[model samples]
Target: MRLRQLLLAITLVFTVAISPIQTDAILAEDMAIIVEVEGDPNKWKAYIEDYHPFVEVIHVYDTLLNALALKGKSKDLYDIDKEDFVRTIHPAQKYEVPNAAHSPSPIKPPKRNVNTPYTGKGVKVGVIDTGMDYSHPDLKRNYKGGYDVVDFDDQPMETLPTEGMPTLHGTHVSGIIAANGEMKGVAPNADLYAYRALGPGGVGSSVGIVAALEKAVEDGMDIINLSLGNSVNSPDWPTSIAVNKAIEMGVAVVIANGNAGPDNWTVASPATSVKALSVGASITEIKIPYLTIPLEDRKLPLQMLVGSPEWNFSKPYQLVNGGLGKEALPDVQGKIVIFKRGEIPFSEKVQVAEKAGAVGVIIYNNEEGVFQGGLTETTSIPVAAMTKEDGEWLLQKGKEKWAYTSYQLVKDKLAPFSSKGPVVANWDIKPEIIAPGVEIASTVPGGYQELQGTSMASPYVAGVLALIKEAHPDWGPNKLKAAVLSTAKPFKNETGSLYQPIEQGMGAIQTEKSINPEILIYESRLTFGKINEGVKEKKVDIVVENRSEETKKFRFDYPHHESGVVWDIPQTFYVKPKEKKHITVGLRVNSRKLEKGLHQGWLTLYNGNDEVYLPYLFVNETADYPKIDGVELTLSPFEQDKFKYSMYLPDGAEQLTIDLYEPESLRYVKTIVEDEEVKPGMHEGIINRGEFVENSYLVFVKIRNGKTYDSFVTEFQNFPLQP
Candidate 1:
């Protein structure tokens, strides 16, 4: 789910050989970039500045990352990249801050239900996103000094609308962590620092993010919250590595898993950073809208989209298919309009429907599961989203629906939009925890606003971490993370099936329990990775630390029965007071006897009656996921009149080909490349220059695996060369 938006065109500095970290094409025009070096960045910067007059050295990050941020033409950078000292030339990536749609007005912030023992007194929390509105009453008290990488200034302020897309995201996130005025956050007394890495429109690049991280560490930040991320899902990405280094330096990092939800492998960096605490979206107790038919068993559970009013109509209204809700319709007064979600924004669809005199709106999923969406503009009537199944059923049945009307509280449910994970290269359970992200009311620039996404959920956990840090000032970052994970509460879905660890990780945070756990466990969950047919067993070790003065006894609880799985359990044992001991757990599996797919469950460890659940899973052979992703086109610099195309082939393709079609109409044009035998990993090539019959065409990548053949249609306008 890589979001496509118009990005800045700039010069790219790099070697002829490119790393997978780059997604955007290197243009001949001057652009900003980060040049990673194997040698000292300071020395590299000095040498570049002294020798290369064409290149502008922005910043040298030598401490945490040996990289030089620069602005120059791709040609000039390429010449410098010829030196062996340069590691990789990285294109400045557009990292977006995830925030659900927001309304023009503020919502009433919820009051704290219970008082906590610690309020993060004296702890320093750094917010790295769009700069905070320090002028806001709720945030001003805790607002500390910070630098602005976006505008290169000392004042880090949220941009005004005159600037790009005016932002309130960082302010909202900051309020969630430490707002102490009319609205009190989880750690209301903590010191807050703002790093405006993202500017107008909440958009930023990799260099700014890395620079911000370096500055935060220099300022001695105890904890850092990054609600920003890119769609590239790789653990080895520069940002992910940078986060890992920060954690190594004893800084706790909390990041939003992503907004691309319910999909496996959608967790983006640096949330994919193994050491950082990744958080997903979940819900607290709240009532949502539902639709029912008189005699039908299908009841559509609807999420009242943010920036829209509640659905108060209890009576059935006539339903009409709006055909994607992009165009106008006649004779639709007082009827409920149904829209299949795609192409247009939720706000636009709702606005169109509202303007057409529709009483209510239903924008159904373009994908499998239900989604949480927002309207930028508040609508006069209620609007909601349903699952693809229910939406299609309505398309067939075409029935007017009645509302549930009564209270049905959804508690501890995973937000449909929170990204899930078993990270690609090494299978790791991301979002090591979950928190309330649905309609969370927090501080905006002008006042309190309710915005949803893992963005809000991340700060909630960061505030929790602050409280934990205050309670145990002597603990390291890993210990703090372990305490939080071991003491969390796992949730079950409506079907009574516990949500998988990959979906909710250790589940929602338990504030009080995490701050003062009886015992702490490190290496929260065991990820066994992909187990092939021949492999019979796998072993993982977890460290448990006793916090009590007395020795603690622990025993392993049997996992639910799976035909081919056997446990190598340790006998009940006692751990010395305040001692940390390594405990081994083994999973012996007979692959032939078990079903050949993803097999997962939980193993419980008990100390007396209190229990700690550890999650483990492995795929047999390999999961049938897409083998290719992200096809991008750029003009070749070395060749004449040729377009350079790049794509990632995770598992090499048996066959790879590109097909061109007429844009909008989708009429077939011609083939660009048809390779019968394609290699694995990243693939790139320069297309042969040919004459074009048309000015523009859509580009598609057709790939083949064992039994699956899929075509990826991508939007590319006006490839100037041969069509």
Candidate 2:
């Protein structure tokens, strides 16, 4: 009897131990989804009501793409997915604000002059973002009408400030377009419509954005600005498709290029829409005074860029050199420490100094240019960077009498956080234009606040587009896009090298030149796909249209690079009045001599005093790196009941290997597949959860294509355990 009782107790304990995991799996329902249904909308609504009452229909699109946004339990999703009329269903993805900086004077178009008639007077622009503060002095005058997709209301202005800073992002974006108070917007007189798709904390789903777009079109908005996007860079994504449709309906759309910067293939979704204007961030040359050190009769100004300028300290402090160690130095305590940039990461060096009781840290560059660095942990002290020259000068001065120093701003440059792109799969140059997005002052909930990101840059272009639309009310979206892109000023880094076309597109928008341009190009930029090593040359044509009434003579000029990439263009050409001419530009690249990366250059067309720029870019292809695509990884349940992964291999792949590892410890777990030959097509595999002991693991897929090898790594966590 006792033995039987013990066995029963063991069974009960086992069931108790696994119940939480099982419950968690059951509770993990699909709350957000987009569904496409066929036939009548009323029938679909009735079907949803009868079969899936728990599911809430958020949006219904009857025109263009037949779709509906529904939130419900996972089982209902499965049932709906199996319905005959249901075309496609996927989770409503989340998109974020890429975030912005300054105003109109940077681009010379609207000119901030009372006499300039193009102030976006008659155009209506729809801003789909966090709700706008309709009461703000600058935005109130231009507030037209909008809808709140989140709350399903007509009043789109933020209503819940007690929750947080309401309407922060939308207000800032609206201010950039039509703010007419203490700060002037790019187009002060444009009509503004606020679509509150994003909620508190600037978070919203793709369904809400789609609803906003549909409503914006229905309201007869001339242009729509989406300063938000996700990191998915496929043109076929739902948001991208919706953006294309909006363009098809004659409304121009502008989206942020995302803030996932300094890396390629980081341009966000919808921004990846070929028809939309993707704007990147650029820094303006606005100087902010930091410090002034007393030196005899004259004060020496020490201007530097602070990593976290929000953390400030003003009292004068002593200086010491805190070498790359946490070891105590008596002089460093209660003083500012100067460190050289080497031997360790900048954040680590600052951390070591902070541990040694340093009040602040100044890291000097090992190279020619100045940089901004930070500590991983938030410190009460200030930290900044100086150029190699400045650092050496400061070190020399430190040896003599104590030197006092303060901070000040220097010339504006590109924000380091601005996302770079040519976009993966297909190399499409993104960030069609750059605008001032660093430390820009714009409208906020209560007053003006300084924020920075590609988000700020996008609205700047939108405002500029409003002006262009006002000036040329009859121009199509493509013509407006071409005018802005062709007239932008190319930007070169401080080192005097032109930024890659993928980085800056056609460069900064030249509003003055874009408006009333003598000529307009059909395409914004030309993209020459991967140039194989043995391929000698390729050709493409750009059509130039003469808008002026008189015959015009033009001179073609292009900058040459040492990358073995050359462009052949006629030095001079002529176009008759109101005529179009195709200019064939030949691209020649010696791939054998060139490095395997994106190569770019500009071809400038000059018509007397007016000039337009076009950018050309190509990726030099080589077998040194394996090419892989269409990668998908998923886990069933929560703790690992099953694992499924699929990916496509290029033609040359000889072997493929898949391995699992413990990411935190970097410990090898198991090899699911090894030394397996893979053909150039969709390959998929599944594994049971029993094979993996840990709840979290990093899956690495390595491919050997010809003589080259490349690997892709992704992480899976909380997979369900097998019974």
Looking at model 1, report the run of 10 residues with the lowest lDDT sum.
1-10
Point to the candidate with the largest TM-score. Answer: 1
User: How many residue pairs of model 1 clash at the backbone?
Assistant: 5
Local distance difference test, per candidate? 0.78, 0.70
**After best superposition, candidate 1 residue 636: deviation in angstroms?**
6.7
Candidate 2 lDDT score at position 12: 22
Model 1 error, position 361 (Å): 2.4
List all candidate RMSDs to the true structure: 5.1, 8.9
lDDT tens per residue, model 1, 430-524: 87899999878888877776778899999999998899898888777898899889999898999998899988998889988888887999996
CA deviation > 4 Å runs, candidate 1? 1-7, 10-33, 47-56, 71-94, 99-106, 112-114, 328-334, 399-407, 635-644, 652-715
* TM-scores for every predicted model: 0.87, 0.76
Tens-place lDDT digits, model 2, residues 19-129: 345536544544555556777655787788788777777667665457666666654555666577777422245665622111122222222323456899999999999
